[model samples]
Target: MMTSIESTPFKRLDAEGRLLKPAHKAETRRPGRFGFRGEIALTIDPPVTLEAAFATAEDGDAGLSFLAGSLSSYKQLPALVEALGAEVKADGKYFIYVSDLDRASRYQINMGGVPLYVLPIDDTSVYNELIDFLYLDKTKMKKFDTAEKLDVIADGAAKYDQAYEAISYEEGLKRL
Candidate 1:
């Protein structure tokens, strides 16, 4: 006779560390007598994604089972991040582009306001490339193409301005 099932309370979070919903019950099955087995069917509101959960964890405390696992087991950060499916960039910084509202909803990532992608900018080229690839093309404003390639130059200046607040290049690289 089973009195109670030992379960881990699972919570959902977005990439920006926002609590998407309250904690839900999740249980792992254990071997039982006479081939009797138990299973847990967990239906997360926004669905459980480690990437979203991790992004949320990075920002602050978000009640997520995987984040809890990563914290409790210090050696699992790399594995945990990998499981989150971080996008790899050629220059630096890990990024996840919120392509559409549907995908954003799945991860609970925001599309407007400040950029939701996480990463650091060191060289101007990398910063320029990132902004150009992600934001510029989506806007109605004119592209910054010029004979002197001034867009890159201007972007470099902006990157420098963000130096104090931006994440270190090495740290961004380590997120992968």
Candidate 2:
């Protein structure tokens, strides 16, 4: 049986590395096999288009799946923002879905405290993106264990320093 590792709790930080207080609180839920059942409560207003990218592994083998698309691609994005009484600053942010399984992952971009952009990112997408960005060999990476893979992910995440936040699946609906 494959062992599961405890993931770090989600934390929000500012650009200067200072921790930011959570603007919203999430509700707790019962844990599932891989982790909590991945679900979100907040419905995307004027649904945006999404395209599935790839999966990291097969079933029961720590699968990470990805979906990619932009909120700007949606025709209703502006109307949605206007409905929310928010401005379009165009400052994009990344919202990471933090499930212990890592398989159920999605990202979002916020404008003026409103999450207006989102895309799914699976483990395969992350790995592929990292290799291309870092100039790493895919064949060599196939030999990596879980810890090593996590390390590589961390390195890649640090390089961009984008405004990103991680949210647990259990708390996502309430918090978002």
Winning model by TM-score:
2
Question: What is the C-alpha lDDT profile of model 2 across 1-176, one tens digit per residue?
Answer: 33222221111111222212322112112121111111211124433322121111112322221111222233333333443231112332222222222333333545345542233334444346556644666787688754344444334433544333544323444443
TM per candidate comes to: 0.17, 0.29
Clashing residue pairs for model 2: 64-123, 65-122, 66-121, 66-122, 67-120
How close to the true structure is residue 13 of candidate 1, measured as C-alpha lDDT?
16
lDDT of each: 0.25, 0.30
Number of backbone collisions per candidate: 1, 5
Residue 96 displacement (Å), model 2: 8.7
> Can you give the lDDT of residue 5 in candidate 1?
18
Question: Tens-digit lDDT track for model 1 on 1-176?
Answer: 32121211122212333333323212212211010011111224523322222111111222211121101111222433333333211222223322111211211112221122333223233324444544444243234223112233223323432222244324433433
The local distance difference test score of model 1 is 0.25
- Give the top-scoring candidate (lDDT): 2
